[model samples]
Target: MAIESEVLVIGGGLAGITSALAAADAGADTRLVSYKQSTLRNASGLVDVLGYTPGGDGPVVDPFDAIPSLPDAHPYRTVGVDTVRDAMAFFDTHAPRYQGHHTDANALVPTHGGTVKPTARYPASAAAGLASDDRDTLLVGFETLPDFNADHAAAHLESAGVPFDVHGVTVPFPGDLRAGAKVTRYAGLLDANPRVSVD
Candidate 1:
């Protein structure tokens, strides 16, 4: 048996998925093939347009403004800034769950490692936690997840001079899972039972 498609995307990673979706949206019969799990499954779910430049001293403030500064050999420069902007707009139109700052500027989002990253777009769920927001914020960490230390992250954010008041607390997740369980297991459980209260 054989399958037919007008557009054949060869991978399942972010780029491939985006290509396939774009092709399908353009009225093409697209088919995507992958040999392994998608890299998106392990990603932080942030759409980072440009975090840094090759020899830049700090994170980029505006990805569009910085595009001209990129080296000639860089992919962004090679494709031209207009193409990058069009790609981002295309992504925004298709991905309703993710959003950008609605401008050429980047949003600063805090990571689990106590560092803030500049991104053009992020998951809508993280909108309230942007470092630019001056509201009081609380970070809750799970005891089973050793990689993320909420208290330490809070302190680091304070030291980094974020414009918001932030605090952290560690608590055990409400489940019978072992301490050694992978983060995916916990995420799967939460997905399976959205009403699983911590209290």
Candidate 2:
């Protein structure tokens, strides 16, 4: 059998894009599938990769600095320290140049201002801009206590001169948050969306 592609992504979120680009750069024909235009339209858009690390130029959180506590049975737990270091280096090398740029050289750097910085390269400004530029954005609002109404988000997008398609999703809830059933429900919603198609 011949190798078809270096990577085949099931979802078209930041992870998928980055993976596809990396694979394609490595000379691979990547295919990405998603329920919506891309994962950028969903809650993945709201992702904030900021978090505290123990060893850094800024302050550290000793408690959170601890590595994965998963048992040996967990595959991720087997990752070597060198692998993690190499990944961090790759991220540092690819960080956006404007991230560290500042208006006042004397003032603190905006990127370094916050105690917690983003782990992902996708900038909030860039994500927001993409959402704005794209027409007929479909924001699937979940119908629950913290439900996000499609019309509400649509209106805000409209005022910002952004076109959108809105729909509300009714997620099943067992009414037990601590049990962790909600996680599966949300995953199901994303799985239901399809790329190159509309719901």
Candidate 3:
């Protein structure tokens, strides 16, 4: 048996979902097929445009600036930097309607493992956690949540020479709800109400 759609997006990863949505919004009958629920559930929910300069050392600051330096085979190199910029623009405009927006530059954000990595765009919620030498920060963790480690993240960020004052505190989830789970589980809240808040 076979199904039909103007665009058939295989895999349910971030890229695939975005592609399917874009195609649908453009008036195409798009369909998505995924082997699992979501490829992003375990993800840090960060958007990384470019992490490195091909095989070069260090991370990229302005991804657009580094585009010309990319190899021909790279996705950005093939589609052209303009495409990336346009996509970013799309996210920037539409993201607010879904509780997110495209960040201007790469940011150092923590992961579920309490490690930090550079990413180009991030949700407004996680954007504030970027490693900054200039901004003072207070890191907090939930006692019930085993996924996030405040101490580990603080140590890692401090060792990286984040200039801002850093501190950690523990918080509790409401009522008997100890899930303290990843935000991805509540993704529907965005669709249900843009103004919805997540803790």
Candidate 4:
């Protein structure tokens, strides 16, 4: 079946969600399609949104303002000063909604340069440790630099007896895993799980 939408978001990852939300907010009829229960479980979960905050317990150096001084070949050099400033402003506006009293009170805030406590939305300890009988097994094919151990994860799944499956797909991009390459891998994962309804 062919579904129509003004903005068809193919992934529910951070960038996708952010895009979908922004598009919808801008009056687009957005539809987010995901092949799994969440786009949060994969590499997206590894990202922490709490990089910097106003009144944060960290060094308080604005990453945007700091980007311009980096070496000529630095990734930030391409970002441009205006982009960083805009991002900093966006974060300044939205961060308060997610901040918690505990985070605000934390003494040591961790920053890129040093350790400084920053407000974050990580799962609470109790929630993180909760036992789950249901599990989804992802079968990753091909190797990339900084490889992850799927064998250990699979062993844990087997011990838990959670539902699982394995499959393989070739990587289109060989050698380096850049931003565009990662998106390709994400699409592959979605293709493998066609049953999921991306909403």
* Most accurate candidate by lDDT: 1
TM-scores for candidates 1 onward, in order: 0.89, 0.34, 0.73, 0.38
lDDT of 2: 0.42
Error of 3 at 64 (Å): 1.2
**Cα lDDT, all candidates:** 0.87, 0.42, 0.70, 0.44
Worst 10 residues of 1 by lDDT: 52-61
Q: Write the per-residue lDDT of candidate 2 for residues 112-146, one digit (tens) a residue.
A: 11112233334434443343244444445344424
Return the TM-score for candidate 4, rounded to 2 decimals: 0.38
Q: Model 4 over residues 1-199: C-alpha lDDT tens digits?
A: 9554598998877667777777886787989998775646543222232344433434333444444556677655776767644553454444444322233222222121112232223233212221221334343433441243345444544454334442223343333345434544655665676564422
Q: Per-residue lDDT tens digits of candidate 3, residues 1-199?
A: 7554488999898788889879888888888999968858767666677877778755777788888888888889899888988897776665663222344567777665556677776676775666653688777766767677777777777777777777666676433443765554334444556674336
Error of 3 at 79 (Å): 2.2
How big is the positional error of residue 83 in model 3, measured in Å on the Cα after superposition? 2.2
lDDT of 1 by residue, 1-199 (tens): 8554599999999889999999998788999999888868888989977888888655888888888988899999999889999999888888889878477888899987768989999999899998889998899888887867899999999888898888999999988888768788888988899898775
Residue 112 miss distance in model 1 (angstroms): 0.5
TM-score of 3: 0.73
Clash-forming residue pairs, model 4: 34-198, 108-116, 108-117, 109-116, 109-117, 110-116, 110-117
Model 1, residue 32: C-alpha shift (Å): 1.0
TM-score ranking, high to low: 1, 3, 4, 2
Give the TM-score comparing model 2 with the true structure, all chains together. 0.34
Q: What is the lDDT of residue 67 in candidate 3?
A: 86
